[model samples]
Target: MTPSESAAAASNDTRTRRSRLLDRVVGSLWPSMALHRATRLMAGGQAIRAFGLFARAARAGSAEAEYQVGRCYLNGAGVPVSRADGFRWIERAAARGHAEAEWILAALYVDGVAPCCDRQDSSGSPLDLFSFDVAPEPDFAAAEKWARRAAEHGSADGQALLGYVLTFGPKSMRDLEEAQHWYKLSAEAGCPQGAYGYGSSLVQSGDSEGDEVRAADYIRLAAQAGLSPAIYLLGMLTERGWGIERDQSAAVQLYRRAAVIGNRSAQTSWGRALMWGVGVEPDRIEGESWLRRAALAGDADAAALIGDIYAEAGALPPNYAEAAIWYRRAAEAGHAAAARTLGLLYLSGTGVGRDPREAMNWLGIAAEAGDRSAQVDLASLLLNDGASHPGDLAKARDWLERAAASGNLLAASHLGVCLLEGIGMDREERLALQWLHQAAREVVSAQYWYGRALSEGRGIEADPSLGRAWVARAAAAGMADAEAALAEMMVNGRGGPKDHGAALDLFERAAAKGHVGAMYALGMMRDGGFDVASDHAAALRWFEAAAERGHEAAQHIVGHSPQQNVRDDR
Candidate 1:
């Protein structure tokens, strides 16, 4: 043969071999391809003619084809999805040993896919993922069996799933050791999820035992792999120093990274850090920005934080109107703090109009959700009201007690007052004093009460010197009542040596800052000619100012004064 003819012959042989190889590969893939096409159609995504072909391949005992076709039927590809048909085909493929089918079945059993056909109903120990689903009765129990079989066959996903099932199955099936074995197997296969599960299993006993470090390590690995769950877990561990040294800065960085990827938990944590300056500088604008973003994304924690920031005034406007609006937004999202704030606004005419009934409604929701602030506020509302208050003093006391249990000093202080006043409990002077002491150690209001009670001998022995010292300490700590009492004692030489000039200076300063009691006190001093050369005109001026500020006694005094009548006629 000529050299050209020889080359041509070689080329033709190569072409023939390539064509045959292509045919073989296509033969292997055609069934799954057809199923993929059917799935697209049923998903309302894309329509094609591969649905019938998939059905044909599935019925012919091709396990790969059965798995693919089952997915389509399960998802309503081309036709309406039939849970019954989907389960049947998948089960058939799984039984025939299709690797993918086995894993898919395990997912279904864990996720609680609805049963549309008698086949799934008949063939399985019907397992619902949660108690919310109805338990099945036919009792094939094949799901667990198949999952174990797939795990035994070395499917990492199957092994992880089997681990979970064994750990949490009904009493008859629960076996922690079996779960641990499967989880370790899957983790050894380089499954990050499996590693996380194994680590969590180690901590089930609640002993640190280095399980936290191991869990954090696995969580970091999973997060690096772009698993949202792992990302959240890593942030949690870092923030809490759980199983490792607390590294808030590192946690914040991780939270930011996860938040950028649309993780709600990360968003909430990031927002909190910005709000509180925890491992970051406090930035109200930035904090509110993150919180708004998270709240829009449906994060309950962020919503609650936003409500808190808007309700309490500092740098933000003190418009209770706007505060009420934000509180309502958060309350609607099931944030108890927000609900409590909303209830407060209603109770006190804060950012919203006062309505005791509405306050009770929102406060009740917060109290039910274990908000300490809500408990105390709700208790106060109930303890002071008539039948229309909507809550009994016993219930109020219960709420207050719970708040006290949570270590809220204000709640403890108020609770002490309730006991002393017989508002919620009998007057147990010793118990009330004990609670007051506890509260005083934690809060200034209690400190003021302690001093006042000691001064008046209310439920305790009166000791003027001790009262003076207590009130002085409270005054230094910025309590208005303490300041007034101490100022009076200073002028009269009751607690300590008289300092008349110093008392005048203190009263003037307090009056300038709008202290009603201070204004009234200064007016009396001037009227009595004890502190300011008997200046009745100046005394009348001070009284008028106090009266304008809603001091009822000052108003009455001014009304009886001849100067007030003369001014009214003018």
Candidate 2:
């Protein structure tokens, strides 16, 4: 054996051991050193170098570095954005028990962010390397799992997010009591979202004054922290005097603050206040601008309110065309009152084409939504079209009954007429009289009908004097039928002394309103000289007018002899 060769081999082995020891020492300290350098580079805006260091640390199994690298990919800090890579890295960090990473994963799953490819083109623009057509759907179960993990690990942000998910998640997953519990814990840890959530819950479900006051306190805390929703809610509570002094002016101020930050509901309230000068000087232009913003954002109430403002004669002139536009928008979004108003516009040809079909469609929509006025209007339209649509009469009666049962006096009047005339059902004189009597207190037409019933003894004992008094009352209110009836009673002396001059005057008044019966009576009176000077030409003219209006007796008289003076038969 050569001693020199053995000594050289031993020296080589010692050098190898020393190099191995140095490599182990460097590996032990490299990740920590690289992580520190990355943080400093990030703070210095050296994103490219920071990302390199973060990548190195991540390869060494550093959770913080993995999270940072994920964020860099997500935000395009050092490279083109890539949500797929970002989510992968974040998921890895979350699996390693990083609380913040877990929370991020939970939020990402709940929000359903796009997961694009990791590739970049020569111009450094993101490319769809995976050819993905759509973003992945939200995974609520995964979100809950990550959120619970982060919350159990003492992350206040995670607690707040968990509470939100539990409170407003899908119907099957909602848990208000558990949500409140998480919110309380997070709020105690100084999370503004947690405070707002807890306060909203207490406000909605508070059982006592103390709970309401506590809710107000928590909401105030969130408002002071600049939470827009909390600010808006506090304004509502202040305006309504719920756990606070009523202060509409102060509430308007709060609404203004929230509105400026793009809260749609706050914008609506602020616009209403400004438009009506409820708690501020009227500013129609500014108010309408705010309302339009909310309406464009799909606020149904705001759209409907804008329609009302344009329709009403206020600071601005009424513009039914513009009102119809807004009403159509709100009605399409299921606003009942807006549908009803739009129906009336179509029915009357006011700022819209006169479309009976459209009117019935919109009126039916509102009626089905429980609008009593809509039901009554729909019934009237149906009844008026009975000749063309024979099936409509029964439907009209059904609608009238519904509205009348809901205490609509006009509906009761219409329904009573239908019963008495056998238009929709068998004649029910007793029911007709009862309904007419009930509606007569507020309805002029009902008053005339009730008077007629009393005079004819259709459903009650005849009381001609009382009937004459009622007809006189309705006549003074300008009812054409009532004027004619009262005039007949005066001429016949059925309930009072006859006054031929007064009866002539009453007949003339009713005829002016196009009452065919009044026209016939006037012809007879003039022909017989019962109320005025006899004039054959005037009698012929009155008879011809009544005949044109489909009066059978007047038509017969006209056919027999237009110039003949007929004797008064009354």
lDDT of each: 0.76, 0.87
Poorly placed runs, candidate 1 (over 4 Å): 1-54, 60-66, 74-88, 91-159, 162-182, 201-209, 235-261, 267-293, 304-366, 384-392, 402-407, 487-520, 529-532, 542-560, 564-570
Residue lDDT tens for model 1, 254-291: 88888888888788888888888888888867877888
Q: Give TM-scores for every candidate, taking all chains together and pairing residue i with residue i.
A: 0.68, 0.75
The regions of model 2 sitting more than 4 angstroms off are 1-183, 314-317, 379-406, 418-435, 454-473, 488-503, 532-535, 547-570
RMSD of each: 8.2, 10.2
* lDDT against true structure, model 1: 0.76
Which residue pairs come into collision in candidate 2?
Answer: none
